[model samples]
Target: MAVRPILIFPDRHLSQPARTVQYFGPKLDTLIQDLMDTLRSTPGVGLAAPQIGVMERVSVIDFSRMKKKLKPAPCQDVRVLINPILLSGSGIQVPREGCLSIPDLLANVRRYEEVRVRIQDQMGAELILTASGFEALALQHEMDHLDGKLFIDRVLNLKTDVFRRKT
Candidate 1:
C-alpha cells in the first residue's frame, strides 16, 4: 500500500462519474489498499477513488473520533467502502465542508443529518450501515465523488458560504 497523489480540481477525471467495480480482483485490492493509505495520510475525514485519479466507486471513511464520547479516543478502524450506494437519508443539515480535490476552500453545504448506506466491503461482502451526524456527512461527501459531484458544487452561496483556509 502506498500513498497516491490526490487529483486536484479542474482535473477532467474528477468530474467524470466513476466506473463500477465489476470484479473483486487483485487490481481492486491494490486500489483499495492505496486508497486506505492515501486517506489516512491526508488530513480529511474521508476520501474517494476519483480524488486519487482512479475512476472507480471506492471510498474510505473514519469518523469514530467525531462522536462526543469517542472524542477522547484515538481513531482506528477505518471503514472501506467499495461501490457504495446511498439507500436513504433524512433531516437536512448545513455543515462546513472541505475537499481534498478542492484544496484551500471550505464551504457550507447541505447534507443529510442521517443516512443509510449499502456498500461492498474489501472482501466484496455487502454491508448495510445507518450513520448520523458527522459520520453521515462524511459518507455522503465521499459517495458524491462516485457520481461526479464535489462539495464545491453544493455550496449554498459562493460569496458567503465559501471560505479560504487559514495558513
Candidate 2:
C-alpha cells in the first residue's frame, strides 16, 4: 500500500458520488491501506477513497493522532468503513471542519453530535457502531464524501462560515 495523491477541491471526481463496494478482496484491502497511509502521512484524521480519485464507498479514520485536537475523545486507533450508511444521527454541532482535499480552506459545518452508522469492515463484515464528539464529526465528514458532498457544502453561510488557514 502507498500514500496516494489526494485530489484537490474542484476536481470533478470529488463531486461525483462513489460507487458501492460490491466486491471485497485484495483491491479493497489495498485501498484501505492506502487510505490509512495517506491519512497518517497528513495531519488529517480521516480520508475517503474518493479523495484519492477512487470512486468507491470506502474510507479510513484514525483519531489516535488527534488526542490534542479533541479532548476526552474515545476514538479507536483506526476504523475502515466500506459501504457506510448513516443509520441515525442525534443532536447537532456546528464544528469548524477542514478537508485534506480542500487544502487551506476551513468552514463551520453543521454535523451531528452523535451518530450511528452501519458499515462493513475491511473483510466485508457488517457492523454497527455509535460515535460522539470528534469521532461522530469525522464519521459524518467522511460519509459525506461517499455521497459527493464536501464539508463546505454543509456550511450554512458560505460568506460567513468559511475561512482560510492562517498559514
Candidate 3:
C-alpha cells in the first residue's frame, strides 16, 4: 500500500459525498491500508477516503498513541470503518478540531460526547460499538467526511470559532 495525497480544503472532492463501499476484497483492503499509511505520515488520528479523493465511504482511525495518556483509548488498534453510520449519540462536546485536509485551521466544532456507530470492518462484518471522549469526537469527525462535510461547516460563527493554527 502507498500513502496517497490528501485532498485539500476547497478541493471539489472534499466537498462531494462519498459513495458507499459496495464490495470488499483486495481493492478495499488496499484503500484501507493506504489510509492508515497516510494517517500515520501525518499528525492526525483519523482519516476518511473522501479526504484522499477516493469518494468512498471508508475511514481509518488509530488511537494507540494516546493509550498511555488516556486510560481507555478509543482505538487500541487501527480500526477500519466502511460505510459506517452513526446509530445513537448523547451528551455534547465541542473540542477544538483540525483536519489534515484543512491543514492550517482549527475550529471548535460541536460533537456528541458519546456515540454508538454501526460499521463494516475491513472484512465486511458488521459490528456496533460505543465510544466516548476523544474517541467519540474522532468518530464523528471522520464520519462527517463521508457526507462531504468539514469541521468548519459545523462552526456556528466562522469569524469566532475558527482560528489558524501556528505553522
Q: Compared with the true structure, what per-residue lDDT tens digits does model 2 show for residues 1-167? A: 79899999999888999999999899888888889889989988889999999999998898785644544665567988899999999998888889999988999988888889999987789999788888899999999999999998888898999999888
lDDT of 1 by residue, 15-87 (tens): 9899988889899999988987887887777889998888999988876535343123222358888888999
Which rank order by lDDT, best down to worst? Answer: 2, 3, 1
Each prediction's TM-score against the native? 0.91, 0.95, 0.94
lDDT of 1: 0.84
Off by over 4 Å in 1: 64-76
Each model's lDDT: 0.84, 0.89, 0.87
TM-score of candidate 3 against the unseen true structure: 0.94
Minimum summed lDDT over a 10-residue window in model 2 is located at 66-75
List where candidate 3 sits over 4 angstroms from the true fold.
67-71
- If candidate 3 were superposed on the true structure by all CA atoms, what would the RMSD be? 1.6
Q: Which ten residues in a row have the lowest lDDT in candidate 1?
A: 67-76
